[model samples]
Target: MTATQLSARALLLDMDGTLVNSDAVVERCWRRWAAAQGLDGDHVMSVVHGRQGHLSMAILLPERPVEQNLAENRAMLAAETADTEGIVPVPGAPRFMAELAGLPHALVTSADTGLARVRMAAAGLPYPELAVTAEQVGASKPDPEGFLKAAAALGVDPADCLVFEDSQAGIQAGLAAGMRVVGVGPRAAAHRPTVQVADLTSVRVTRDADGGLLVAL
Candidate 1:
């Protein structure tokens, strides 16, 4: 199906595993945290992806106070942001971003502004003209707040936006916002998004004969 065939008006994209391949970087950071706490790092990172930072810290360091976990996780994330050697743009992500520029597109992510900037800069991707970070919304993915915030920022109604996400939490957020969702990445199918593609490499947006943009996957 094409995007023009549908009524979608805007595009909302996730940052981490979706637009940029930061899985290894994230896993490494979380592993350090786990080691410090004497828990399995891989296990912690597995539960952390697509979830809020504070939430992930809470899951991994349940014994620690929420504030403490938040502080530690934030610090670790800051360090990770500074060390973005392996983090790069996902395949087709840069081209996709370039194609979507000057259109109604927004980055809606659970990452805070600082870390988002670091990752995006490392990926050598164009910065979104509009963005909604974790700090901008009271609630994160699965709550619909982030996606809703992006729609609001774009001056588009929830139903008019099409979201591309890779995480269950992010897909749920888009779905909850009453928008169509396109899932990307290995774990995308778990979210049951409206359309699922293996990666950005499988999708493209083009203008149809009708002069409307068609998102093909």
Candidate 2:
């Protein structure tokens, strides 16, 4: 595919599959929970990415009470945080982050503050100073709240913000927030982001003459 250039005043980023490959820990904790719940681990995994643990649990076990999901989610978060054996920065993530120095960007992730900190630290990536974590949003991805909040916090119009995401849910949230999305990694290819890239290595960010971001994907 031909590379595409997109213009934006700010960038909103997702955490898990986008900047950090925490699948090993996520799968380990979630699969264990799935088994205890008598649900198929594979199917649970499908709905878990890009969502908060409680939200994912609610989706997989619709009949479960919100309180129950919330309780279980807390436990799941602890387990995932404790096990970072396979966590690593996505390819080119460190370089990509360095290029964003002094640029307008904020992390918008489903992981709460603690989990976000743990994962980013484990992956040896710099955490953005501005972040909208699960605790900051009333709704998860596939709902525009998180992205919209990030754009607002950065004082940029939603249309002028670009979102970097790797899951279907995150892509949908970005679009729903009226922002363009640069899907990263294999999973995002099928989500119909504004444009798709294999990883951060395929992305380049530069300042345009107007002082806005010029993102080449």
Candidate 3:
């Protein structure tokens, strides 16, 4: 659908891969973790996309108990924080965010609160007025918990919001929450979002004559 087709009251956005270029850092951290566990980094990265660290740990090292996975994930997060040199905002993300500033919007991410802060700060991204971090939601992407929580926090019905995402799992979560989805990035095209664009550069949010927010792509 075109941006004119969407009449959104709020916007829900994802962090990694969407507003931020954390993919390399994520893959490197996960690969490091996988190596320590004698697993393949490629395999781990694929399974962990848009998933919480705990979930990724569990999947990568299923033989270990949940507690251990949690600990390892924390350690990995620390490593990632120390290596934040490469982290930066996605193309056009800063401008897109500026466009949405002061508007109703929330960031929903699979990263735990601490990790989320570290990443967002590193990328010089503004913190959303509202957010659903890994600690706040029971389920991660591919599940609607985060997106739904964002909608609730924004005081908007799911149907009245639009979700911006990059991963297949994230797009699925937005759709599951009954919100329109705008996908960004290369893999975004595979998810069949309401709209697909290479980056936030292709997207624009404007006030419609009807006094509603219109999202265009």
Best by TM-score: 2
Best by lDDT: 2
TM-score of each: 0.91, 0.98, 0.93
Better of 1 and 3 by TM-score: 3
Better of 1 and 3 by lDDT: 3
Superposition TM-score, candidate 2 onto the true structure = 0.98
lDDT of 3 by residue, 1-217 (tens): 4344567999898999899898878877787778888898788877887888778778767788999878877887778767786898988888888889878889999887777788888888888878899889888888998988888887889999999898888999999999999888986898899888788876788778866688877
lDDT of 2 by residue, 38-87 (tens): 98999998899999989988888889899999998898888887898999
State how far residue 158 of model 1 sits from its true place (Å).
0.9
Residue 109 miss distance in model 2 (angstroms):
0.2
Q: What are the candidates' C-alpha RMSDs? A: 2.3, 1.0, 1.9
Query: What's the residue-level lDDT of 135 in candidate 1?
Result: 86
* Rank by lDDT (best first): 2, 3, 1
Candidate 3 lDDT score at position 213: 82
Question: By TM-score, is 1 or 2 better?
Answer: 2
Model 2 gets an lDDT of: 0.92
The 0-to-1 C-alpha lDDT of every candidate, in the order given, reads 0.83, 0.92, 0.84
